[model samples]
Target: MYCYPPHPVRGHPCDNISGNYGTWQANAIQREVVVVGGGAAGLSAARTLIRNGVKNIALLEAQDYLGGRVKTHRQDGILTEDGAEWIHGGSANRLYGLARRMGVLSPRVPDSSYAWSAKTETGRNADPAGYDAAETLYEICERNSVLSQYSDFGYGKCYADKFSGEYRRNRGRRSERAAWLHFLEMWVNKDTGLDDWRDQSARDADHFTDWGLDQWDQWRAGYDALVAHLKKDIPAGTISMSSPVCKIFWDQGDKGQVLVVTQSGVSYLADHALITASVGHLKERQDSLFEPALPRAYRDALAVTELGLADKVQLGWRSSWWGEPHYNLNIIFTNDIQGEKSWLKGIMEFLTIHNQSNMLQAFVPGEYARKMEALPEETVKRHLLSFLADVTGKSIPEPSFFRRTQWQKNVWMRGSYNSYVTVEGGNTIMRSRQPLAQAVEKNGKPVLLWAGEHTHTTRYGTVDGAMDTGEREAYKIIDYMDATFG
Candidate 1:
């Protein structure tokens, strides 16, 4: 089970404890709280607030739908996820726990086969012995806490300089070396959502806590079920869909209420406001989103943190092409000289969707993912079919249906997820995850608080992290209300 560290509630110096605390009034109409963005964090925050007797709250979602990065699509009676597909951890994961309760949790089969490709020809099978040696090296790194020891280097640097040497010595074959390196590259890219592992902070990557499970688990019924579960307790009329917040007006005067204005000129005033926008969106609009502007510290944090793109292409065929697969095919394109700079580089892996015989989903990450999102639908489909045929060494048929996720182009979510980047001679990770609690009033009242996956140090870039931040901010607000308004 995953354990959360205790987050201390910050002292609100702006709250007037002595005289007429609860009766203090401002010019604008008052609300208990206003939550911006209706993703996992926002929904969780709203739920937490309502459960704790904070009813006078407003939740705003820019999109018509509730789930942010956890979108699910159904085509031709087949359910496939457009966003997050797996629960990274075991029972300790909050989303996993929710899935179990909802009876949507399913054990993801640990079945994968890799194929190697050279400049001239593609191999039918990958070097199993070489792959095992690479796995052994990875195990050694994990067991000895190699990344923690080498905090100065990035994941790519550490692997290339240290671990790669060990693997090369064990394997010794040039073909095997290329295959292993390509596999590692694909693995790290998919895991971190970064274009290259060199961009990933080794220390930050090692800091994540997991359930010690090797295999991944999925929500069979789709992530929308989990979103619906979260929304179950939230009161109706509290959530306002399609209400994009334009600007947040705060820090007006002593005891002044925070004003949240929508794009359509509708405004709501609240004692406190929680900004649950994605780090990508925050990075793009932080300067203009706030009326008084954000603090330098917050801006610096945003600058240091990294948001990456990850996209999925789901193809549904009329019939299953690969006859009763003994094991799942995980195609890794190694040296495709013909299509090095195209969508082929971004094609990390293709897997047959669990329980869906005729469906295949391609995992695309990094800069290539953004590029894939820009290409024409037919262009992507044609390239994917040609690439798959080359890797499998068989003629592949066209899919009846095709769907791709455009997270990079999504206005609400400029990128798929967040990852920490190394900043020289400073605590960049902590700064990046630090809650935005700048005192908006003389009495130490924080009118603005930030929550999202990016705001979590250990669990950033996951649904669990988003939910945790939401609950954490909600508790902080609850504590502040109890202390000040009680």
Candidate 2:
């Protein structure tokens, strides 16, 4: 998807290039391996392959820039993350470990009661206990014991069946308890990126190994820093940006060569090909992109899995009107029905950007994410500023910087978050992604390999998960080369 520019950065030059190992210019393009996608997984694979002595590599990136969903934009001198915001898990997270090495894993600002305030859409202070009460039910829903029975149904079913009762028992207002529950659902919806949580597989939800709190740490410097780190080991000329793959002929020629065709009409032939495109792109392009068509197993996996949509918006001010520097304004709308084009209702919360007191950011979930993107930038800004004014009773000033992301609308990406097991899929989360992870062999040689967060069983929907998949596939190629070519 995204990658470092083909041209070298001044400090990081691409030199000592080593390649052309395959016969007949490696069947034309002279590549022993062709990596299709330059996101974390693709870049990791390229670096690992080069380190392991397979230097005849060509990495094709669809986007002009690197970091696929890990993009960041400059907002009044602050790095506003458009995709990945936090470093999930603790020391167990590989990215977290990298951050530790980079000396950037340390928290920038402390999170506390002073950091957050809750309010309803009517500009009234929502009861803090209502949120706590919702959180109590949320923790219950997270428990394995709660959703075990609904394994075949959904995590939504468990919440639907029990949340209202929990609300009533916790002394929540009967008239407005439903609104609070909706707020809780929206918060959780951003987790999996589903408008209807009922579509999520309850049984498979717990398959992911919980390292710790999903946001145990974050990159206040911006996630692009990590992308820069991943590409340091790769040779300069190895990456080719503005190269979106069109067709993949995996089992090609007598020697089992793989031919990768890009939209630019350039074809790269290699002994092996590693594809790390997002599942959203794959699901959208699978039928047309793969030659000889994907196998029944992969097709089934793609068909059943869900890659959802999420959007982000950031606003930065030269001066501050908001009281607290780290204020997290949590909005819970009591309105049961959504107004026409009322996508602003989809915003779960707006928090002061970490370490950037002049900035605030918000995330939109599900269909509303797409809807928000369709509106004019000015329209979106007006609604947001008006709402903040109404809630806080302060005249809001124009932001010095304002930006929003359209992850759902990007053709190369198709969605924001990673894939998940669907209740309708009738397979475990692992079972769904496992088939796609397997290499497609020709005459016992790996001709095609898959790597992405979607291909990871336990670590899907994480940056480390994506990098791990890339490393996993790179080793598969390494082992194959050692056994065959060596």
Candidate 3:
């Protein structure tokens, strides 16, 4: 079986595609507002401003392509998400809501009918009780009410205490408990995209706001459909692709305006500059990117919050080799396994995708993610294939297609997924991101506004969170045409 036929290849839209490769030229272009970074937050902010009658908006993206972390990769007939796969919620989710109205959603797979199996790295069937224990722990973590009880705790403490208590109270076999407990440790690292959960604030998990929609799926065309839809209403040539904003001289101009300079020396003069770059990118470039430098409070906020890496290794075949309609093979690593391929410890499951039939993937998050990303493609495929064969004890057929994501290495993205609230990276200040979300002021009016997932208070690290921040910033400009910046 295969997935849907390939859609026509597209160049996305409004891409003034040129990079820093050729002869450099410097020029200044003026506009009402300048949007830096063409990811979800930037595109959302641009569209909202335009619709609210704020025309002459210029969106400058560093990379040649848009969609930032919402990127979708397609090769031959195989389609895989290089970044985000789930919309995370249904109708109330801003992106999912737009996809709903646009009727661009892909058909949902009957995942409930799928098959699941667990085995040790030594090719022995793992005790199902361990799998059961891990599954129960996953369910408990999903309950916001339960997580809230640990509001003052770190994720490491809360989940660990919970996992230990649950199995002890249930009177489960110690051997079975130990098996999944090892799996659970790796699972937490991957799920949170952090090397150690002690750094993860339990308060952050309790802060998540869920939209009450059952469907969490992908688009019919691909994730870029959302990007295209956001760009459709904004004027053509509004976006300058391959244009990375190197310096933002927010309060430098004599005309009480701002100057945003790209890497190629193209300056965009505008009344206000809406910055929607990822926190990772901002963290990396903050010192030099800002003219007068980000305020001390914002710098402190950046220090306390951390961005995590979550990389994927995907394989596609002509037909289903696993046989089951929805097959999930979970590998539970034992204590004895060690050596050169220890990085393989990060991968725990081989699960099928929702709408695609020919593909299966494993995510490598936390500490090993960067190490795995640095390996050569052939090396990765050979090791991953061997790992699969060892755990399954089956003569696994070679996949026709293989891919892995390197979000950490990608210059623009810096890391995969979103920000995590650190327990003690700096002073907690009650775990508030308010300073990071606040706008920079000039002459008692807003000149440099921030928009991105990191800005949302309750919904950090989600697509909806990013959308909310973008719209929130756009509305701020609309509401306060002239006012004090907070």
Candidate 4:
């Protein structure tokens, strides 16, 4: 249940043995634990350690601000969430519980709403053919037994195989089938942030346990409020912002103290270190970031664990264009069917920000999201405007203000969140969640630990998962400290 260093020691060597070992002890910048990353996991770890009475700790964050991907941006008078927006499990969720305690929980919105965009019509009301397709897809989602049959296949492939066969048998037309496929793809993309359903695992897709029917809730004050609440009890100067860790040197000469060096050249020596960096960041910098390099098993795990992109483009309008207030406007672009040549393939759902009348947020997932990140700001804005015009069948005015999240471009966070890519008979996620090392050292010395959403198998890609992992790593460090000092 807990992990600790192998060799037990009394009080910290720097505190008790400083006078005896002056040369080494005096020069070392000592800490009981060092947490890398200031996101949900890092903050949760810090809170856990502080609650457990561990005082000497440092939290280093690559970004200037806390809350890794749970960021909120304000444009004009409206507030828009650029990163995480929903508390997925409502009251039953751990993050939701924290939000309730913090008094930031908002009213629950509908899980989702649907709309169809065709050549002649574009609105919530769908034609008979479109309605049938939507209903069929909904049935597929609700029927877990049906989905379980294709556990070994890619979700997209399986759906296509089954749905296509059914449509053909029912005398469905080509255009109607295309409409169904488009809707299904958009739905899948919205849920998993994967552009192609083929990239998702059929088994893993159905593995997620829905906490409740009305599980989605937004924060009234914003996600930053939760971050601040988590840090409320933490000692001042505990977190170092704009401090990106460059290298971690563990199991150093003899005494085995771990050294963490940031990009700015500051070094920290700690008995144990918890690395809560996003999997994307780790994937990007794994080779050169660690002094001795990560183990081959860890490397292999990282390779198999896929990180995905889900970028948001927030538009602030002078007036509301949507007909009514809905949780989300599911845009099924069926009119412009260029097969593989369409640029609108990745654009899926448009979310209505809570109480922000003038704000509408569009999500771009998968490879299209990556491509969107590379395009110039003006170009992206133009493309979105044109798409909206086409969907609404009315000329739309340029937004009063616009902003997009470039998670992939951010050196600190390479993608929005973790995604499951099917690998034949492989449980890459479970393997990746394993401890980086039993105790971070072969000789019972403390070294490095990992915590992130990617490290939580059941709740991967959720805020609660990140918070849970942070607390888990914190407990590991606490146990290590207790065993070492006893």
Candidate 5:
């Protein structure tokens, strides 16, 4: 569904409306706060706001459904994920706590060896992994970030320290160096979607604070449950779905009110509006327009920020032949025959399949993730067949069902959340979380605030990080309001 132009009728400036005499009195409604985007960040922000004694908050989401990217679709008793599947950094993740509290099924790592497969140049399986070989491959990947770097962004930057001779004394055979590099390149490409590892700054590489590669937890009942449970505390009708925010007009110069316009041609006026949409969503002019415009510092910070893509393609099998009692999954490599190279490919080369009984899933990230969204179904099926053939000795029958979700193409969420650090093509810590006060000075009082994953300093990109940021921003707003009005 295309959300088109949002024609806002010109009216009294917010400062005039917000004053005891003008716009503030005219447009100033009594809602505690207005939060844009009802995803993890938005929900967490609202919850925090209410807990902090702020009630009558309104949440606006572009999609009819609430859960932004953490949705589940159950078909024929098989559960399929159209958005988020795995929970990274289980220990510190607040979502994990919520999952357990809400009684949702938690995902655990299967304690067994995974299957491996080989494929042809045109993306056809050619080799199968013997029991020990797959284990050995897993060991190699476990010890080295090279595989992750290669799988994620195809930049091979994850292993920059190792590749740059940091581990020269412990290097493997010279003849195999080329092969290993090639394999790593494939991993990086699939993981991050960049052609050159150098395209990313080394500092950006270090930005991922919640790095849990060894173990990943999946939400069995569907990750969306958290979204629903969080929504329950919020009063009905507080959330307005299918409402894409067009522009935000903040009169920080005189009054402290923030006005938000929706694509459906509706206008909302409130004391404050907290933005929690995706970073990529900010790339749009419609998404960024603010009354009196944003400060140059905030503008520069937003301009420098980079958005990464993470996408998923889920396929369902009739039977659970892929799972073994020992290890419930395998990451079969069907490509990477050549040495390190970078480019987006049509074929599903780098794949990690999750064997969760009725459902099997493969993740395609970075640039290829963008390409997969446009690929033909038959071609995609062929690629999966080839991958399965290489990993498992037997050719499991064609999957009874197939479904995929593309974050890059999704309107509400332009791309998946990927973390980044300061040194690499990112804004400084000061710029990231600049308070609304810093954005503007109103009657000697600062106004016009900003928050989201992009505004977070310590933890950014993860759902937990988003929540932490939302809560932090809410308190900042409350503090600002009290300090000013009191």
Candidate 6:
């Protein structure tokens, strides 16, 4: 049987820095920069700072481990992931180069062939042609732009508005535009857990460039190896986990020294601090108390930025039932056959990895991801098994082991990484997410900086995005320091 970690309670289980109350006494350490979150973004920022000879730095992570979203688990002789499973893209991913350099990347993944099966509306095996349709839809999306598809947020303006007369006429004949739009929505739903892509601003989708599309790799060692590699260079004590930063006392009344206070009362004073916490973590208005409060722009942005949800469910069977030890399997459009009426069915995409030994996983996104997080173990297992049997038309026995992650409820993450359309007052708020790029000066001194995947307009919601953002933040700080102190 695969042993899992003790279930965590909301806000407390992995609170590493919470117990060290003595560290909160307003340490008089003169640090140049303090990086928070210790995830890929923060760790990358800290590493860059160290490489640049900025020794007066500190990192804070809320979890016990360094890798934030990249986590690997081993169960029932099957390697699994509680967080990130695949590297997402191949050579196009910036992390790809870094991973290869660090020897944590695999150039060729094992033969993981996916067999997609969808159900008809009647709970019967849908036409085998459904996969072909899905394949055609994927090709169309790749050929056309997502931004141009649903130009008007759900019927505001028809697709005709964005096309020429001839093209518009052709699209209008069979309402192909609307049909194509539905396929696009399905694509987004399965890929990133974003539902109703029409609601997302076209501009947000406009700037998207998928670097992971070229080649993809899955790490058997868990995506966390990237985090491990990041920490290997930094001194062990530089990063502190289990510390929930409660209040940040920055630019005390404009000229006062900046102080960061954790829930346990540890305070770290620094000349400047990079707040790299997730956008969701900052949602609970009362959770992070900012002394003197954040700027109006930041407050506005925080209120409008939407945090999307993504969750993973891994099941380990006692014996290899699929009869293949190394093949990646995926079942798409299973809902069409199961006749299921649940929100999760909309975003269910299963990908199998982990030594392929009867271990399978379902990548649930959006509302379904949220629901799965709240389900009982047995209930979740039964539902998954039943669905699998229907798709394969075979009675697949129950999985001996079960593990599911409720990332939406995870205090550290709150929600999965998603690039949302800037909502009402979102533009002003997005500026606050930027790192030193939007540095504010107080009495001829800049006291605050920001950096995280959310802050990057171009590279948001991927490992490469986080890495590039971290690197950018480091350069911004370095440039500012050089110009000011030099």
Candidate 5 at 13: error in angstroms?
26
Candidate 4 structure, TM-score to reference: 0.85
- Superior candidate under TM-score, 4 versus 6: 4
Per-residue lDDT tens digits of candidate 4, residues 295-330? 656666666556778888888777777655553555
Judged by lDDT against the true structure, how good is candidate 1? Answer: 0.70
Q: Please, what is the TM-score per model?
A: 0.87, 0.91, 0.89, 0.85, 0.76, 0.81
Question: Residue-wise lDDT of candidate 1 within 1-486, one digit each (tens)?
Answer: 112113212231111122221222233345789999888899999999999999999998988889788788886688988777778768778777788887899866764432222221263566554555555655554433666765665656656665557666676466557656666666567766888777766666666665544657888878788789889999888998987876677765567568777665567778889989887777776655676866666665666666777788877778877665322455444465454336667664566787776777767888788888888888888877877777777788878888888888887787886555543312343422453323344366767888888778678878898899899988988998899889
Residue-level lDDT of model 2, residues 23-111, one tens digit each, is: 32344586899999998889889989999999989999989998887887874467878887787767777878788889777574555
* Residue-level lDDT tens digits of model 5 in 378-416: 766666666556545567688787776677777666677
Q: Which ten residues in a row have the lowest lDDT in candidate 5?
A: 12-21
Shift in Å, residue 94, candidate 3: 3.4
- State the local distance difference test value for candidate 6: 0.60
Please give the ranking of all candidate structures by TM-score, highest first, separated by commas: 2, 3, 1, 4, 6, 5
For every candidate, C-alpha RMSD to the true structure in Å? 7.9, 6.8, 7.7, 7.5, 7.3, 7.0
Clashes of each: 6, 2, 0, 0, 33, 13
Better of 3 and 5 by lDDT: 3
Q: In model 5, which runs have C-alpha deviations exceeding 4 angstroms?
A: 1-30, 105-107, 111-179, 185-196, 286-288, 321-355, 390-396, 419-447
Q: Which candidate comes out best when scored by TM-score?
A: 2
lDDT value for model 4:
0.70
Over 4 Å off, model 2: 1-27, 336-341, 427-432
TM-score of 3: 0.89
Collision pairs in model 3: none
lDDT of each: 0.70, 0.77, 0.75, 0.70, 0.56, 0.60
lDDT of 6 by residue, 27-126 (tens): 5455678787887788888998888888788887777777677677765556677765556557767667777777766545443444444443223543
- The residue pairs in collision within model 4 are none
Ranking by lDDT: 2, 3, 1, 4, 6, 5
